[model samples]
Target: MDIRPIRTDRLSDKIVNQMIQMMREGNLKSGDKLPNEGMLAEQFGVSRGILREALTQLQAQGYIRRKPKDGTYIQDDIQSMLMNDSVNELLKKTTYSDLLDFRETLELKMVEKVIERASDEEIEEIIEGLGVADNEKVQHDMDHYFHYKLAQASKNIFFMNFIDTYYDLITEIAVKSNRDQVRRNQIAEEHLAIAKAISARDKEAAKNAVLHHMKMVDKTVIGEEGK
Candidate 1:
């Protein structure tokens, strides 16, 4: 009810963030209908076109569902919506090489941070995460869990959010590259090595481990593409 007027250069982004925050704070509940474009735009002191653009972005991000002749409603399963949308958007915009490069950059920094910041218990938790992929029934879910745990071990909220946001894309690439049993086993081994390096608080070793793992992933994905 306390919607403030927007005056920033990035009006649409600000609007989207404000709406998302409102939803998070329970001011807007699931199934609640958003005000019509004109009314809401007026309330925000923005042009209707800007409001529409923000609404479209929100819809794309799965925050709201727009129906024909009806209002936009909050999504019931916000987390799923976000994950699916994030992956879909990444898939639309990036190539395999791009994804790999971004992931390598993120993970290398993440491991270094973990070595510098993570507690003993957090390191143990990261090691425990590797157990997920050690099973005979190793799956993409396990890979996602392991990487997520590693990112969390970095003790940086920004790193955690970046990993969590693009996790589906990361897991998709892992699943594709891991179809071969040999590659799967190699990946599991790499995860364990990375976990151990982090546990030892060896920043250089951890960085090396991550870089090697990413190289293997890149090779696997590209080799598969060629085949």
Candidate 2:
């Protein structure tokens, strides 16, 4: 059977994606002023009205800001707001297994990035900063804390923020299903292996460490098949 036409982006969303692309590519930097509406509309090949709609959404999402006369400029500190409320809400709809898969991938990439980009001092910092989240603190998650510090070491905001967004769900699960002291000790050692591997700049070891940790999580939380 032939497939029907795929759903395409709404015109305004297409425009919005282009601008966000520009920002991602460094063509548009935070605190940089934008061209006037007429010129921007011409550049985007869209009606001024449609461009305005896209801009309105960006402004609401913390991507841009307006002034009485200075027109629009990129937000001065945009990185922290990269994962806005809308994306966070969408992330909420994912299943626990889906989240486990995502977490495994994100942490592995973070380890790789940390190995590649972090300074020696940064590596040491990461090694020392493996925070022990006291399970007694119902609000804290030991697992999330360890991985988040690794994310920071990776020096990639997008990855770091995704891990940060993941914290609430991890904490919720931890609170609902308390592990025994034996499991906690095992995970803590797994985390230590990850940090040691990262400090040694041994990518394969780091990958193995992360995989083992995820496997333990998968078995206990989502079962062997992650179903």
Candidate 3:
């Protein structure tokens, strides 16, 4: 059998992963103080230096906070903003085609939730600012308004973050494509109609609007060269 010794240099990352696993298992929780370095090093079968390095990394990442007088405790708000930092990095490898696929597949959930759960007042907030979509001065600004606010109105923080994460690319495509004013006008009207459908709580209209919008978006910029 082939065998190799474990590399000590990677222990710090391993410690972080182990602790994160414990957190996920609920054995550790928000605002709970971590053990002293020596004890933690012993528990993880590592030296104190490795444990300290892991703790420092966690503190830097906003997963924990160190109090000079007290000790290190899990950050109180970690649950709400679970960014999944490593997982999100995979977005770096994503293509515009992949982005279009995400819109085509996942955004239906967003519309459905907004229709079922959002208040009339919350829905009104997004559509109100959309103004005349073809208005040359504010049209670009209004593009993000409808989608971003509607994501917020979905009442799902995870969905909101997902949309927020990819939204920059969405805007990038729009900015590049809308250099042609006619295309810009069409996009503005489409987004306005879609937002209004959601505001009216018309599920069929909202879905058709979203799919139609994506069809236009797919046909616009973002060629294979850009990917």
Candidate 4:
């Protein structure tokens, strides 16, 4: 159980996610008896009640089992729990507009970071990434990796992590059913301009390029939402 006080409002969710991680790491197995309520509360630095609440949620979610006289045990069908929870969470909190907004902010900030730490090697990576995007058989994962590589070139840990986390959301949107070909072409062109700006060490140009890229995506998303 090894619960801890939640630092954020997503504490219960964090507890569940950590437990799932433990299972994935092989630290916990099906039918494993998790630490009892008292010990679990101590481990998480939270009170008994919060720990119980988290455990109850897990049980209802089919991630665990609890017995009156016995202890809590991991569920046998953990994958189903994981799949359902992940999909529901993604659907509940995410929308096309959300992805657009995220890409708009993250891409522009990534440009600022890239300009601040631009180097020959970094510029080369960005050029390679752009080449990948130009391919006819380009896949979402390929595009995601391309952007991730460009973010890595920025040599800023914060920028890299931010892009890695949010880039998938952009890839999801880009691959969605409603994706417009005309807007996609516009965005691709913006990517080319951004790469050129980075290659030339033009910070302002790179920032403006990303801003324009996002503006186009924003407009497309809004237009689609209206329909």
- TM-score for each predicted model, relative to the true structure: 0.60, 0.62, 0.71, 0.52
Model 4 ranges with Cα > 4 A deviation = 1-95, 131-139, 170-172, 177-184
What residue pairs are clashing in model 1?
none
TM for candidate 2 is 0.62
lDDT of 1 by residue, 68-100 (tens): 898888988875555555566665588778878
Top candidate on TM-score is 3
lDDT of 3 by residue, 131-220 (tens): 544443355566666677878888887776677667665565656665667877677678777778888889889889899988887887
Kindly list the per-residue Cα lDDT of model 4 for residues 1-227, writing each as its tens digit: 99988666667666777878887667887778999889998998878877888888888877899888999999886765555556545644777677567666777777777777768787777676653233323644555665777778767655555555565545544555224455446656777888888778787898888788668657755664575
Q: Tell me each candidate's RMSD, in Å, in order.
A: 11.1, 7.4, 5.9, 11.7
- Kindly give the stretch of ten consecutive residues in candidate 4 with the minimal lDDT sum: 131-140
| C-alpha local distance difference test of each model | 0.79, 0.78, 0.75, 0.69
Error of 3 at 5 (Å): 27
Positional deviation of residue 82's Cα in model 1 after best superposition, in angstroms:
12
Ranking by TM-score: 3, 2, 1, 4
lDDT of 2 by residue, 1-227 (tens): 99899897888999888888777777888899999999999988999999999999999877999997779999987654553654677778987788889989888888999999988897787667554444534323666666777888788877777888887766656544434556666766888899899889999999999999889877777542343
Alpha-carbon shift of residue 189 in model 4 (angstroms)? 1.7
- In angstroms, give how far residue 155 of model 2 lies from its true place: 1.2
**N/CA/C clash count, model 2:** 0
Report the number of clashing residue pairs per model.
0, 0, 0, 3
Error of 3 at 84 (Å): 2.9
* Root-mean-square deviation of candidate 1: 11.1
